[model samples]
Each structure stands twice: as C-alpha cells, then as structure tokens.
Target: MKSKPVLTILHRLAILAYVVFALFPLFWLLKVSVTPNDLLYSEGVRMWPSRTSFDHYAFVIAHSAFPTFFKNSLIVAGSTAVTVTILASLAGYALSRFNFKAKYWIVALMLITQMFPLVMLVAPIFKMLSPLGLTNSLTGLVIVYTAFNVPFATFLMQSFFDGIPKDLEEAAMIDGATQFVAFRQIILPLTLPGIAATLGFVFTAAWSELLFALMLISGNDSSTFPVGLLTFVSKFSVDFGQMMAAGVLALIPACLFFLLIQRYLVQGLTAGAVKG
Candidate 1:
C-alpha cells in the first residue's frame, strides 16, 4: 500500500515538533545564559532576550571555581572513558570469540554487576576507599567511574565484536599473526565505531555524575563541573545567569570529544568480511 502525501507531511511535522519540544529547554538555557541579569526577571519569559551579554560567562571563568571543576571533570572523565574502553574491548572480544570454561559464569557475573543500583554500593565503596585515602581524590573518582562504566562498555563492545566476523582474525592468524596482533590490526580497526560509542558513553557519564562526586569529594579543589554548578546556588537564591553560563561551558568538552571521534563512529566496518 502507498502512503498518502498528506500523511507523510504530517509525519514529518510530528517529528519536527518533537525535536523542537525536546530541544526547547536547551535553547532556553542558551538564551538565558547570554541574557543580562537586569533583564532576567523583568523580561517576563521572552525567547531570545532583547539584550545579551557575556558578563556571566566572564565571571564564571574568571571569578569562580568553574575552571578547576572543568579541569577535574575532564581528567576524571577522559581517564575513565579511555580505561573503560580498553578493558571493555579486550573483555568484549574475549566474550565474543573465546569458548572457555566458566565463560557463561563470567558473562553472568558481569551482567550481574549491571543489575544493582549504584546508590546501594556507595557506602561500601566509600568505606573501602576511605582506608586507602582515595575518597577525596580525583583519581578515586576516576577509578569508581571506570569500574561502573566498564561492564556496560564491555557489553556494548561485545555486541560490536559479535557483529564482526571470526574469519578476519582467523585469516590473519593463518598469515602468521598472533591473536594479539590480529586483534590490534584487523579486529580493532573494525571496532572503531564501538570504541567511539563506548568512549563517548563513559565520558558523558563521568562528566555529569554529581551524587558520587558530592558524596566522595568534600573539597572545592576536586569537585567536578556538576558539583561546581551546585555552588552557584546560595542559601536563599540560585545564580541563574552564572549557573547557565557554566552549564553551557561544561558542554564544550563533550561536544569536542564527540567531534574528534565522529569520523570513526560510522556504522558497518565489517560489512564485507563475511557472507550473508
């Protein structure tokens, strides 16, 4: 059956409406970030304020702890993303290809790790890290983030590996390449999309995590951008301008990281490797 032109136009309109509806808040945030404070309340809910200024941006960068927060968040998130991706790729490939004793149990255990709520583990994790003096440290946060992200990342990577073929590595091995060499050369190249996806996933998770950072790190020095965003709220009122400005700034690194990896994020690196 052929669809009507009017129905297709309506369908496109529906999608466009949903997209704009979902993105409206972000658009508002960007608008308010540049809006002058004097006009914040006086403007009475206008889109694209009549006047805009970079004063809040300047203040957040120069007068606040936003820079430190940005740096700490970057380091923790970048480290966690890289570490988790490395571990995940290796484990995922193993899960996809190897048939060893207890493989089922190992996969089940990793899945089990994903089942529990992270909130439930906070107390025990804090107690464990406290004795080692790691609670207040950025390294501690990275370690925790990596631990949480790895299982999911492993699963993500495993799906990608499963999508790829066994024949490519088998061929490489037949050509005298070791398993590691074959993986590093042939398999890894095919899994670039999975790697980019995992890295972006882990990085964004660690970047915006606030509850754990708030619970673990008490000092201003080690606070991540999410936690620092909270500091903009005083006992009486929130500094909307500065907070919005900081939020906009915090989005930059994630945007940049994705932009850097987007080239390899295209699907189907393994299309021709196997027969249908």
Candidate 2:
C-alpha cells in the first residue's frame, strides 16, 4: 500500500519528463517562428523573446515559393502512403495466411533491402529513373517512396494481421463469403488500427524524406517541402525566421493526419497493453 503511491508518483514524473523532451523542439520551432529577425541573434537563446512577430509567417506564405513546395509534398506523401498501404495490406495478408514457395527467400530479400544504406542506391535509382523521364517529377518520387516503404509497411501490417485469428475468416466463408469478400469486408474493417498505424508511418516518412526528393527532383516546379527550404539559403546567411515559420507550417498536415486517425492509432499501438 505504501509503495503504490510512490510508484504512481514516479510513473507520472517519468511521463511528464518524456512529454517535455518530445515537445521541446516543436516549442522552440514555434518560439523562433514568432520571434522577429532582429531579436533572433540578440535574444541569446532566451525561452521567450522580448518581442514577437508573425512577419515571417506572412512572408513565407505570400512572398516565397513555399506554397508550391507544400502542395507538391502533400501530393507525393499522400500518394505514396495510399499506394504503399494498399499494397502492404494485400502482401501482408498473403504473407500471414498463405505459405508458399520461396517465402523464406522473399522475406530475406526484404530484410536485405532495409540493411543497405540508402545512399548506396541513390546513384543507381537516379540512373534508372532518368532514362524513363521520371527525374524531376512528383510521380517519380511517389514511385520511389512506395518502393522503399513497401517492405517495411508490409511487415508492420503483418504484425497486426498475426494478432487476429483465422477463425473469423472460416466463419465468414461458412456463411457463403468468398476469401476476397471476407478480407475486404470483415478482415479489413477489423484491421482499421493496423491500416491507421501504417498510414501514419508511411505518411510521416514520405513527408520528411529529403535525400531522394533532392536527387530525383531538380526544378522548383517539382520540389517537395524539404527540398524547397533550400531557397532560404543563399551564398552566406540562412533565413532562420522564414525557415522556422515554414517548418511550423509543414507540421500542420502531419498533426491533422494523426488527429484524424488517432482513434485507431491508440487502439493499434496499445492493443496488447493489458495483456497478462
């Protein structure tokens, strides 16, 4: 009885500490975004600047190429997430339910793909895409992002599928449902948490991806948010104000995305929480 209260206190403290640690950077980004350019260097890392302004936000929205970049990023990340999730759902179901020839080799190949440094494949990927008129296009980026993310997303989806029982499928079949119908109507709805989790993972990854976007896309017309940040840097100085404002803006869609799916996210992530 005496130890319970103490343990509770410690657990709460630990959670508080973790929350602060995770959100500190976002707070700083918001802080910097509102701080005036003149106060940035003079302020000397103060928690709150003496003065604040939304000038940076205004400039980034109206006077910069950031809106175009934002649009392009939304397109690439959204397309990649949707495509990867659909493919992963089917592949993961097959991997979970069906035992087939070369299954071990297929899984091994996926693991191998993850182990190699992304840098090693950059040159080869660029060479392959360029010949097909894929370079400097959002379509190229989506295809690349989907390819790299499918193996991991499939594995993630498979974990959720494994947790569900096959009895449901058998029962549905007994009721005159076909395999595809059962999967489409029954298993898919039950796997909402998994789909939500996978969408969040793939969306976040593609949204923040810079290297492949940089290598595959060249023109501002095709640039994503991360690559478009380069416009703030010129020969000498970095525009911290507009850059931070843009950074803050970039975080909105991701936050809204998780917000929309957080119901399933929490269920999927914490499903085994109460396990014995």
Candidate 3:
C-alpha cells in the first residue's frame, strides 16, 4: 500500500513535468502575444505580463497580408493532403496485396525517389514547372507538395493496409464483388484511421513547408503562411509579438483538422477487418 502511494506520487510528478514541458511554449506564445511592445524589452523576461492586450492579434489579422497567406496555405495543404491520401491509399493497397512483374523494381524506384534530398531536386522541379507555367500557382504548390509527401504517405498507408487482413477482400470477392468494389465497400471503410492519419500528416507537412513555397511562389498573391511570416522581419528589427500571434493563428487549421478527425482516428478502424 505504501509503495502504491509512492508510485502514484511519481506518476503524478511525471505527468506534471510533461505537461509543463509541452505547454510552456504555448504559454509563452500567449504571454508574449499579450505583452505590449513598450514592455516587451522593459519587462526583461518575466513570466506573465504586468499588462496584456489583444493588439498584436488584432493587427496581424487586420493590417497584415497574413489572411491571404493563410488562405493559400490552406488551399495548398488541403489539396495536397486529399490528393496524397487518395493516391497513397490506392498505391499502398496495391503494394500491400498485388504482385506482378517489375513490382520489386517499381518499389525500389519509389524508395530511390525518397532517398534523394529534396533540396537537390528543387531546381529541377522549378524548371519543369516553370515551362508549364505552373510556377507561383497554388496548383503548382499542390502538385509539388503532393509529389514530395506521397512517398512517405504511401509507406504510412501501406503499413496500415498491412495491418489489415487480405482475407476480408478475398471473402468479398468470393461473395461476387469485384476487386474495386471489395476495396471500396469493404477494405476502405476499415482504413479510416489510416486515412485520417495520412491526411493529418500530409496536411501538416505541406502547411509548414517553406523551401518549396518560397522557391516556387514569388509574390504575396501566392505566398503561404510560412513565407508570409518572413514579412514580419525587416532589415532592422523583428516583430516578435506579431510573429507569435501569426504563429498562433496559423495553428488553428491543423488543430481544427485533428479535432474533426479525432473520433475516427480512434485506434480500432481495422479491428474487425482482421483476426489475431
């Protein structure tokens, strides 16, 4: 009984430490967002401000081009996520189940594609897209982001598909359903968790990707939120509060996305799709 209490105390301490570690940055962001410009340096690194205001958030949302950047980021991220997930699901399922000549070589090539550093390919990608007049376009960003994210997403989705049994689809086939019908009506439903995971992964990756966005997109019209964040910096000083406020604001979609999918993200999407 005494040991149990000691263990409980230790568990509580661990949880407390983790919470502080994880939440401290967010707390700081909120604190700095509210800290007025005058007191920013004057306060000299104190926890909690002597005063607080909504001015930074107000300015960021109103006076800044952040909204447009935000919209563009959303379009790119959302499009990339949906496209990559759909492609990954189909490709992953194929990788997981079907076998044909050159399958090994095809998988090897896909793996090779992932091995090359993205930075090395950026110029070539730009050149290819430039001739097609896709540069500075949201569609171009989507295509690029989808291509980059799909290989990883495919591995992610293939693992999920592997976790499911091939028997389910076989049973459906025996019941006279076509393979695509079995995939749609049977296997797909059970892969919701994996789908949600892939969407979240790809969305978050594209949402924050800076290099490609910065390289391919030129004007504010095509800027993503990450590139827009750079506008807060001038040749002189950085606007810390406004930047933090923008950072906070940029987190909304990703958080809302996870919240929307959290229920389906429950761990058992494939529970009945297989047996031990």
Candidate 4:
C-alpha cells in the first residue's frame, strides 16, 4: 500500500519532466521575444530577461505583413483539414464496411504513396500546378495539403470504424434504416475521437508546411506564416525577437484548434468504457 503512493508520485514526476523538456524551446522563444535587444547578448543565457517589453510583438503586428500571412495560413489549413476529413470519413467507412475485389489493391496503392519522399514529388507537382495557375495561390496549397493528408486520414478513420460494432448498424438496418443512415447517425457519432484526431493532424500538417508554401507561393499576399517568418532575415542580420514573436503568434491557431476538439477526443475515449 505504501509503495503504491510512491509509484504514483514517481509517475507524475516523470510526466512533468517530459512536459518541461518538450516545452523548454517554446518557453525560451517567449523569453527571447520579450527580452530587449540591447540586453539579448549581454544577458548571457539567462532563464528570464531582467527587462521585458512587447516591442517585437508591436513591430510584427504594426509594421509587417504577418497579419496577411496569418490569414492565408488559416484559410489554407482550415480548408485542407475539412476537405480531408470529409473525404477520409467516406473512404474509411467504405473500407471498413465493404469487401470488394479491388480493396487490397486500393490499400496497396495508398501505402505506396506514403513510401516515397515528398521532396521527390515537388518538381512534378509544381510543373503540373503551374499550367493550371495554381502556383502562388492559397487554393493550390489547400489542394496539395488535402491530397497529401487524405490517405493517412482514411487509414486512421478506418481503424476507428473497425472499433465500432457492426451490429449497431445491422440493428439499425433491421429497423428499416439504410446503411448510410445508420452510419450517419450511429457510426459517425461514435467516431468523434477519430475525426477530431484527423482534424488536428491535418490542420497541424497544413499550418506548419514550409517546403510546399515556399515552393508554390511567390509574394507576401499568398505567403503562409512559415514562409512569412523569412522576412525577419536580411543580408546584415536576423531579427530574432521579431521572428520569435511571429512564431508565438503562429502557435495561437493550432492551440485554439486543439482546444476546440479536446472535448470530443475525451468523449470518444470514454465511450467504449460504458455499456447499455
């Protein structure tokens, strides 16, 4: 009995340690952004600055094109996540519920797409999109993100659907409901965790995407926050404070996204524990 409390304490301490290790970089970025430029180097690796100010944040918001970049990122990431989730849900349900002749081949082809490095596809994708006027466009970025994310999202949703009992839908069918209706009301509601996880995964992937954004976008008008962070660098020097400030701002949407979906994720996890 005494050892149980000790184990519990050690477990919590381990988790706390991992959390600090993960968050240390972000904490340092926030610290540096608030540190005055004159003291940045002179402070010599201090945990917190002696003097703090919001001048970097002020400059980024008031004088830079960060707001436009933020807007572009929100549009692209949000659009991609929604598109991927909807398509993945339908595809996943099919994979879970149906057994067709081409099912194995379809799964193999999807897996093949994941085996190749994305860098290998950049030139071919760019070549294809350029003629369609998709290069240097937010819509192009969204399309690319959605296509890249869907296969994995489909697999994820399929696993979630597999966890659900087929009898639930079967019972609904016995009650005169079609497969689609049972899936819409019963299976889909039960897969909220999977859907939320897919949304967060796709949203984060689209939001932080740099290679595609850098390759496809040309000007500030279409730039995402990842690409926009480059503006802090110049021939003479890098604006560390402003760059960190922009990074901090970029994290806001991702944080808010998880916050919105966290309830569904928790609910989904606990749903399996209860019995009717």
Candidate 5:
C-alpha cells in the first residue's frame, strides 16, 4: 500500500513538472504582453511586471496588418486541415481494409518523400509555382500546406483505422451496405479522436509554418501570422511588447480549436477503453 501511494505521488509530480515545463514559455509570453514597455527590461527577469497595459494588444489589433495575416492564416490552415482530412480518410481506409499490389510501393514512396529535406525542394517548388502565378497567393499556400500535411495525416488515420475491427465493416456489409457506406457510417464515426487529432496536427503545422510562407508570400495582403510577426522587427530596434501581444493573439485560435475538438478526442478514447 505504501509503495503504491508513493509511486502514484511520483507519477503525479512528474506530470505536473512536465506541464509546467511546457507552459512556461506561453506564460512568459502572456506576462510580457501585459507588461508595460518601459518596465519590460527594467523588471529584470521578474515573474510579473510592476505595471501592465493593454496598449500593445490594442496597437497590434488596430494599427498593424495583423488582422489580414490572421484571416489569411485562418483560411489557409482551415482549408488545409479539411482537405487533408478528406483525402487521408479515403486513403487510410483503403490502406487499412484492402491488400493491393501497389499499396506497398505507395507507402514506400510516402516514406521516401519524408526522408528528403524540405529545403532542397523549395527552389524547385518556387520555380514551378512562379510560372503559374501562385507566388504571393493564399491559394498557393493552402495547396502547398495540404500537400505537405496529407502524408502524415494519412498515416495517422491509417493507424486509427487499423485499431478498429474489420468485423464491424463486414457485419455492416452483410446487412446490405457497400464498403464505402460501411466505412462512412460505421468506421469513420468511431475514429473521431483520430480525425480531431489529425485536424489539430495539420492546423497547428500549417498555422506555425513560416519558411514556405516567407519564401512564397512577399506582400502583406497574403502573409500569414507567422510572417506577419516579422513586421515588428526593424534594423534599429525590436518591439518586444507588441510582438508578444501579437503572439498571444496568434495562440487564441489554436487554443480554441483544440478546446472544441477535445470532447471528441476524450469520447474516442473512452470508446476505445470500453471496447478493449
């Protein structure tokens, strides 16, 4: 009994420590965003500042082009997540349910693509897109993000599908349902956690993506939040307060997105536990 209690205490402590470690940066960002610019450096590494103001947030919202960046990022990331999810679902179902001659090769190709550095492909991708007028366009960014995210999303969905019993689909088929219908009505619904996880993963990846956005988008009109953050830096100085405020704003959508999907994730886990 004593050993069990001690082990439980240690486990809880470990989780608490990890949580603090992960959230410390976000806490600091929030702190600096609230801290007055005058007291920022003067505070000398304090947890909280002497004085606080919302001026930085106000400036970022009203004065900067952050709104446009925010909108563009929303459109791009949301579109990419939805598109990847749809494609990955179909592909994952196929991979999980069927055995085809080309399946091995297809998986191999995807793994090979992941092996190459993204940097090496940037030049070729830019060259190809430039002629098509895709440079500096939000559509172009969405296309690139979807393509990049689909492979991983497919693997994620495949793993989820693998966990589900084939008997469920077989039973549905025996009841006069086609494979696609069975997949749609039976298998897909149960993979809500996997879907939510994929959405969150792709959204977060597309949301924070800077390299491609920077290389492809030149104008502020099409820039995403990651690129928009760079506007705060200048040759002479950097606006730390305003930058932190912008970062806080950037985090809001991602936080809300996960919160919305968390229920489905929990439900999926519960279902899996009960099934097991």
Candidate 6:
C-alpha cells in the first residue's frame, strides 16, 4: 500500500493541479482585461505584459450600456432563482413526501423534458411568449428561465428531501404543527444547503443564458450579460480588451453569491445526520 504521507501529498497535488487548471482561464481573463490594447498582440504569449492599464474597464463602465444589461441580468437571474426555488421546493417536497397516483409518470415526464435539446425548443418558446407580450421583457426572460430550470431544481430538492428522514416533520406534527408549518420551520432549515445550491445553479443558468435571450430580446435595454457580451463583437473586429474586462466584472456577483451562501453548502452532505 502507498504510505499515508505519500498518498496525502498525491491527493493535495491532484487538487492543486485541478485548481490551477480551472482557475487559469480566469487568471488569463483578468490579465488580458488589464493588458493595454497596443500591447495586446505584441506581448504575444508572455504571462504578463510589461505594463497594464484600466482603460478598457474604464471605457466599458463609463461609456458602454453594460449597466443596463447588468441590471436586467440581475433582475432576471434573481427572480428566476427565487421563483424556481420556491416552486421546486414545493414540488420536490410533494414528490418526496406524498405518494399519489401518477407520481411515477410525473417524474418520468420531468426527466423527458431534460432529454430534448434546448435549441429545438427555443423557437416554439419564442413563438408562444411573443404573442403574450412576454418577449423582450425581463419578466418574460424570467418565466422562460424558470420553466427550463424548475424540473432540474425540483429533482435536486427531491434528492435532498430524500436524505432527510420523515420523522423530523412527523415529530413536529405531533406537537400540533401542521405539515406546512413543520416544513417551513424545521425541514427548510435542514435543507439550507440544497436551497442554496438550487439558488446558485438557477441564478447562474439565468445569468448566462444566451439562446433564449438572443431569440427573444431584440433590444439592448432588456439584454442580459451573455447577450451584452456580443455587443463587443462587430462585423469588422472584436474588442478583446473591453470584452475581457466585462467578463472579469461579470464574475464578481457569482463569486459573492457563492461566498454568501457557502456556509450552507458546507454541511449539505451531512444534513439530518445529527438530527437522526
């Protein structure tokens, strides 16, 4: 057998290697964001340019319509995350706790929705929403995103509910609390990690969604970050510096979001262990 110290070193090395692999793109993004346009190509493949400036970032912030795009994205992503979480929680809890007829078919149907390519569905979705006056609106984007995300989010929460024993809620009910009350106060707290995870997943999905945003939204006023990123691309040339700067700025909210709820995620795997 491998020695403990050798095994530990190998494990740590593997993690370090993976971290570097994953973070290298982000590092390059930030690096290029700060790199001067004049030196962008001249610097070649050097790890860092001889010097850097905030010109691209300054221009993108002060001059571009990115603010509008950022606002729309925040509203859409936040709304979608909250809406999907609430609906998914109720649906997942139902699927986990209740054994009504058609439960098997309901789950199978949900699974089937995930099997189709989103590309094939976007046109139909656009056509359906366009007549309802939902197209090009943030609310419409949220509705579309929520519809796409709820199924997976429901399955995710259902798994979390499965890990939790029914005894906790039963005990609560024995104390005169209704099922909804027990769920709200007791089960919801224990399911924090799942909720946090679902929120993050849905938020990221809505935040980065492009196909639906592209097909539905025609104006810059309602564009999300992913769509706004395309504004930097033109018929003649691409604005790499400003685009990279915008990309770097986009990472902030997601990073802060995870940091805010990271504590809840820490104990997800061990949920209900102490209670049971």
lDDT of 2 by residue, 18-84 (tens): 9999999999999999999999998697999998999999999999999999999999999999999
Better of 1 and 5 by lDDT: 1
Which lDDT value does model 3 have at 15?
100
Pairs that collide in candidate 3 are: none
Q: Backbone clashes per model, in order?
A: 0, 0, 0, 0, 0, 0
- Model 6 superposed RMSD (Cα): 1.7
Which 10-residue window in model 2 sums to the lowest lDDT? 267-276
Tell me each candidate's TM-score: 0.96, 0.95, 0.94, 0.96, 0.96, 0.96
How well is each residue in 69-96 modelled by candidate 5, as lDDT tens digits?
A: 9999999999999999999988988898
CA shift of 116, model 1, Å: 2.0
Residue 180 local lDDT, model 5:
83
Show where candidate 6 strays beyond 4 Å: 1-3, 268-276
* Each prediction's whole-model lDDT (CA): 0.93, 0.93, 0.92, 0.93, 0.92, 0.93
Ten residues in sequence with the least summed lDDT for candidate 3: 267-276
- lDDT, candidate 3, 1-276, per-residue tens: 356888899999999999999999998988898899999999788999999988999999999999999999999999999999999999999999988788899788888999988899999999999999999999999999988888889989999889888788889999999999999998888889999999999999999999999999999999999999999998999999999999999999999999999987899666544565
Worst 10 residues of 1 by lDDT: 267-276
**What tens digits encode model 1's per-residue C-alpha lDDT throughout 203-232?**
999999988999999989999999999999
Q: What is the lDDT of candidate 3?
A: 0.92
Residue runs of model 4 more than 4 Å from their true location after superposition: 1-3, 267-276
